[model samples]
Target: MTALTQNRHSPCIGICKLDESTGFCLGCGRSGDEIGAWASLDEAGKDAIWQLIPERLQALSVRVRLLPYAGGELLDWVGETIREGRGTWVAGAPGAVAEFPCHDRDATVTRGEDELTAAMPKARFRLKGSEKLRAFAFDGDGPVVLGLPKRRVALPMAEVVTPLGPDEAAIDPEFRDHELFDIGVARRASRFCVRTGDAELIAALRAAEGRHWTELMAKTGATIIEKSPHRVVETGLARIEVFAEIPPPGGTSPTGPHTHLLAEFLTTGEEIPAALGLPEYAAPIAIFYPGTPPA
Candidate 1:
């Protein structure tokens, strides 16, 4: 029973040629190439270039964009604590597991700034067969930087969006705390569901949402998003877009303010393991990568 480790084949397609005008790569799906070509292109061309690109795509890859804290908090779930009842996903467990410490089925281990800063270089060590990194940044596939056990895990989650400021957005509590992390662990265990379609899946998400809300209401004895209408929109003939402004598993107020890692799932009456590049709801340990919260 081993824990999850790095993929030897990083989603790195070594295409580094930048398209100066588009800031994107004809080689890779990046956006830094076109800045140099800007003067030569029409304003319309520049407008059409990056309608949907995230401001940070130029600095992201499948490895880093999706999972940035590969070294720092990446191994937060992988450790002897799997047996210590500490975090959630215990390292060597086989076949659909949850984070190591259940912690009452509704609590989270805090990886607050102090913890992260202290665990610094040690957390940066790479796992067996994985390459090490120097100075982990949000741009590249951050440091593998740790001796990790290889195992597939999943998480369960529900997102609650909040306003950070006039422009910036971030997850509440500033980051994914323990409860949120468990969703990932739950995903792999058939213990979680993150579906977007199908009456049953929708019902499940609603149930998860309800459970979360009810727990919060019970704890804080306050009402939040309880009045917001949770519904679906017809995005396509057979596909409907479902959305809700629920809160994070931890509580009502977010840490700073920003969007969370919410996504749309398409169900064809079959088990979908993914939502676009995002992992399906049943992911054991969500690989969350919080960025510089909007200021």
Candidate 2:
């Protein structure tokens, strides 16, 4: 059969509900008119409509039922799909659907519904138990789609908070601790460091090597002092000397001095220490010498 013939099939994945705001079906991302006229439409017409489904899905808000599976169940499903070389794995519940492409040999999915919870080998998904809850995944190196279950009434697009870029991040002193500093003599001299015990961030840094590491560090608004054998960044206030260093066997970071390259900081330009308003004493900082201040 020709590719075009195969393309004639419907895109529906069983869930059938219209997003009132956009008048698009959540399952197939098709309008009522499009769905009704699908049979009458020519191949060209169908092609045109198919072209719009992705955009419609991106814009429309649809709700789906949650899969009542434990963390292990979900993880097992993901692992099986990957092992079987399934091009895509999809799960649906009532009015919702979640789908992802599975091809990586080393993708890892852990149990957690928190943001930046882990390195997320390829993609990270978080789910909370609530009828009105929406499960989403990190847009790392893969694509993830979740048809969130929301109230019957969907909010206007204008009300949604669009993410800001690194350049557009608001200047807030609250993120002061996230700042990097330069301090040390000899081998550590002129190096910058940001202390953090966040295992997720550490893992991400370790995974992002070479150009990926460089690009990730650039988001910190830090000056690139070095970028070859090891990456060194300067945030005017401090320097990152030990970026991407893994912790010891117990997962505890070194006591003296180290660097952190958190994915949250790279993507959102927000520092956890600053957002939590942690005190200087409790902040993630590793001074070279006791009582010695950062440069």
* TM-score, prediction 1: 0.22
- Cα lDDT tens digits for candidate 1, 61-107: 43323222234334353332222333222111122211112222232
Which has the greatest TM-score?
2
lDDT per residue (tens digit) for residues 49-160 in model 2: 8677655665653322122222334334334444444444332211111223334334343443421111123222222222222212211212223222222222222111
TM-score of each: 0.22, 0.24
CA lDDT, every model vs. true structure: 0.26, 0.33
Best by lDDT: 2
